[model samples]
Target: MKIWSSEHIFENPWELVVRAQWRKYPNKFNQAVEGIDVVDRQIDSKGVLRSHRLLSTRWGIPDWATKIIGSDGVGHASEHSAVDPRNKTMELKTRNLTFCSKITIDEKLVYSPHPEDKNKTCLKQEAVINVKGVPLGSYIESFVCDHISKNASKGREAMDHVINTIKLETVELQKEAKHAMESINLNFDI
Candidate 1:
């Protein structure tokens, strides 16, 4: 078993970060994630947005697993996400479904507002992996742990890009609103 953790501080607020997260996949920085199909989406009783998705992904792994397992390295992952605007937090969990017990991997992520800096958000990532079905389980687990750590950092960079895009859109909208307001003329009837 291997457990790994990573953290990043995003320049955007939690609200913007969470919005970016929902559209993070399939971006330029994360080409490993090929597709996502939403299985379920709804608002919980507490008004939190909950969603379940099937994700198809392929990433770098040791060549031996492909030979020993007799299967391609593509991974079909199940992902669940929850966004609680009231609590100003977002949580996501994902696990691999293809290998199951042979090479199981589970990841959890939490996004929250930074305590000291309201404009910044903190993303905490954690992953647990097990590869006991293979002869070199220990070595494989270590390799996977390292890969996950590196992936976490790349994921953060992708999210930052998403948030910046949102910010640009917001600025454009504000500009339009300001222009419209300037053109409006109020006439007094009385």
Candidate 2:
């Protein structure tokens, strides 16, 4: 088993960041994520929103993995997330369902408003890479770990890009609202 974790602080408020999370899919930054289908969504008794999604991703695996998982290079994962507005926290988990006979990837994320800075948010991400059905466990583990690590780096960059785009869009919307208010005020004064 290989473990990896990351921590990131976003300049945007937690609320905005969480809201933008829903729109992150289908963005240019997340090109590898081919599709997402909402399997279930509902607000629990505690008012926490819960959702399950089936995500399809197109990923290229290495030669050794290709032989084991197949050569077509496509994988699917199940994602589950919860939004707790009252607690100002969002939690998510993703697990690869394809090629389980060879390997499995389980990822979890916990997001919350920064304790010191209300305008910022903190994200803690962890992933467990489990390789199975191999006698040379150590050697295969190293290679699989390296691949997941590289893929994770790309995923982090893409997430940052998506967040920045959301921030820009928010700023533009604020500017438009300000202009509309000013125009309305001017017309009323005249």
| Candidate 1 TM-score versus the reference | 0.89
lDDT tens digits by residue: candidate 1, 1-190: 9999888888878888988998898788768998899999999899999999999988655589587766677789999999999999999999999878789899999999999999999989899999866888999899889888877777888988888888899999999998777667332322
Please report the candidate that would top lDDT against the real structure: 1
TM-score to native of every candidate shown: 0.89, 0.84
* lDDT, model 1, position 84: 92
C-alpha lDDT (0 to 100) for residue 147 of candidate 2: 68
Residue 143 displacement in candidate 2 (angstroms):
2.6
**Clash totals, every prediction:** 0, 0
Error of 1 at 173 (Å): 2.1
Model 2 segments beyond 4 Å from truth? 27-30, 62-68, 182-190
- What C-alpha lDDT, on a 0 to 100 scale, does residue 172 get in candidate 1? 100
Question: Model-by-model lDDT, in order?
Answer: 0.88, 0.83
